[model samples]
Target: MTSVPTPDPGPGRQSRPAPHDQRSRPVPRPRPPGPADEPFDLLGIGIGPFNLSLAALADGVPGLAAAFYDQRPDFRWHPGLLIDGATLQVPFLADLVTLADPASHWTFLNYLKHRERLFPFYFAERFHVHRAEYDAYCRWVAESLPSTHFGQQADTVRWNAARGLFEVDHTHLDEHGEAEALDRTYARHLVLGIGTEPYVPEPLRPLADAPAVPVVHSAQYTENRERLLAAEHITVIGSGQSGAEVFLDLLRARPAGYERITWLARTPAFAPMEYSKLGLEHFTPDYTRYFHALPEQVRDRLVPQQWQLHKGIDTETITAIHDELYRRTLDGGWPDAVLTPGVSVRTAGRLGSREVELHLEHAEQGTRSRLVTSAVVLATGYRERPLDRLLAPLGPALRTDAAGRPAVDALHRLELDRSVTGRVYVQNAERHTHGVGAPDLGLAAWRSAVILNDLTALLTGEEHYPLPVRTAFTTFGLGGPPPAATGTATRTAALRHG
Candidate 1:
């Protein structure tokens, strides 16, 4: 079998110029780098971790032209909340390329080796690595792939019936900081991984534009951390991982400094996620089947009850926060950070030059108000961007659930209108149809494999790479060695599921 050449590693996050002709050097022209006018078999909309995985999978496939585009000036995955002590919620094995191919050149292990930290990391015996480390690993992959275009945002995507292809329109600024609408690309398949936008409630939307209030989301916390660190008092809204992490980070910023923190959350208590080994099967292939087989009402009911399990922090992170709280208490600090559980921020407005007032309420008690100095960080999380904005031209042929999220096949292909010829796939936005694993890291490789298999099957009428079938505990490596008597049965069962 043939393989794609491994890309070279480099420092910094600048896009490499297209390969040059070595025979005779020519003067550079004022044109955008990379293949802008060229047609491709696949055009990925966003270069986040999900599409980055797909890019790795596509790298090994022959004659399968693909390129990814991102609006950011450079690749950055959650830079705002990469707190000094913050680590990933999932294992390091759940990185961009590991599960797809353990021997992948872009594996996190390879990244550690490149940085000469492999020995140190293993000695650490930590399943979860620092988020900063993962960010570095992603940047390495982005730097190697010269085909990726940064600072180029897709303005519009429309299906061209006459051309029998999807046309993507994008705009990027020139080196001089002048905006230019220079090109478009036609593709047989389009993968939309545009990610999500921070979700601010209706009451809080006004604060989104309030510069005085400093109503920034958790995603931008790093950029504004200095401002927040200088504040006398701050209020952090929401109780999810981001909210909790931000709260903790603020509290520990200046070990002995005086900075009051108010943590307003809707939940009665700060809950850690349920992540027992067997319980994690809900995020495995088996759970995808179990979830898909359940009745619509039952599935809907289960989602909210188990929301904490899939949506909250891992035990390690929870424990760290608990330890910090304990240490502060032992130091006689007594957690100047107040946890107003079961309370919600109703409205926020600027009080004066550097102060802000917030309307807060408790379900059991009457509504009340409070004032705080400096800023309010809204770690309210994110919401899936409406695919219809991109799929409107193709909406008539698309399928949706009662909640309006796209209805996708097992292969991750959108069930589109009959007029749609070539397939369109999605990632990071399938929470409803595919269950919790839709935006999960554990299933990134598996999802890519499924999508690739579907495409290959469409092209060659054969399954190229399929998902592994799950087996019972003893036989499938879940428990002991496979039973000698049912080895054949196990394989058959595995094949059936795949």
Candidate 2:
């Protein structure tokens, strides 16, 4: 890796401003003969935060050649869901490289320092960063990293048995999102960080499809916020953080007594997220290992039972929603809003070109109802983009689980046929195998480090990244020997205890 100068903002000292040219430096675009002639050591499919984390960490490593591709023209993280005052669930330390390599220049602190906001941020003492600021920080890293190539959509990936490498075919899209050219690149290893897509449930799929009633997913909320607010009646579905934020934003925007809004969810209540210190240990690598070791059926059962970990609303958001409703009730009347839980959207259809009717059923009450609304916002969360289309050429080499999902190993590599020598790894696409932590921002850097270390181990027969000794205080299983005992005695003691 090339050596770059590090900026040291000494204790209680702020760094000087970047020069005009340095501040205005444009993102470097890869030239026409992109990685085709000279193959890269690593080639990444999508330039999301997960893969961007890998690129940022890989930058500090020596003799590692890598390139990342994305279909979009630039990096933007959930631009729509970046509601005002919305903060990330995780702290700033969970950036691209801090947890893995704090010394790296790509840290969020460095971004603040470079942008001349270090002192202000220090004074603010904000542990959880605002969503917009986090997006800007990621954009800063994506723009600075020379290895990232935007506007290139990877179409297919195939293993070249003769060359012992993977070939990726891509179409270079113009600013208009039109395909301008086609190209291919070869790499010894491949990493898929294609990320997730907004999911609309089957019952509401048709309404979300039709352009008549202005139905939109929370992923596109910001773009349609004004229209949604102007409607006579608006409904927000799902009980996750996104849904809560969207409902809160709309609630604050509309008049107190005139707010015609309905918030519905399949969950029994607007439950608070599991934010206890020890409860968070489930996101640690140790818990991930234990979860992966369980039987497939057990893993499936535990995921739904742990919904509060990832699916529940943040306490702050829930409080804000209640506070807003309470303040509106001061006028001797409740706000014109309905908040219901344990309700599922059975089906949806257009009442007219300007309105939508939803068939709803309550789980506990065993009752049914219909809601007519001018607009709908579905915040039903995201699903991992399937790799079937892209990996069609290598389909025969892929090993799948009982549910027909790809079997991702502990190192995040897809279980592939023995004949295929090249490795195909995944990011944010292994929740079934690695558990909920697979898509968590806090684990991005750690997973990236693991992938890099595994890659290096394959090449040099030695670990490149230092693995964490231990991450969680809670021991996940009873099969392990007591911490106090040693070696042979520990095994003897375990047998005796048994």
The candidate that wins on lDDT is: 2
True lDDT of residue 157, candidate 1? 72
Residues 9-32 of candidate 2 have per-residue lDDT tens digits of 112222222365686364556543
Deviating ranges (above 4 Å) for candidate 1: 1-38, 175-178, 255-257, 293-297, 331-333, 364-373, 471-498
**Candidate lDDT values, in order:** 0.68, 0.83
Q: List the residue pairs that clash in candidate 1.
A: 397-417
Taking the tens digit of each residue's C-alpha lDDT, what string does model 1 give over 73-173? Answer: 66788888888878888899998767656766668897677666899998999998888988988877776654455666676677778777887766675
Model 1 lDDT, residue 424, Cα: 88
- The most accurate candidate by TM-score is 2
Q: State TM-scores per candidate.
A: 0.84, 0.92
Evaluate residue 461 in candidate 1 and report its C-alpha lDDT on the 0 to 100 scale.
60
Model 2: pairs clashing at backbone N, Cα or C within 3 Å: none
User: How many Å off is the CA of 458 in candidate 1?
Assistant: 1.3
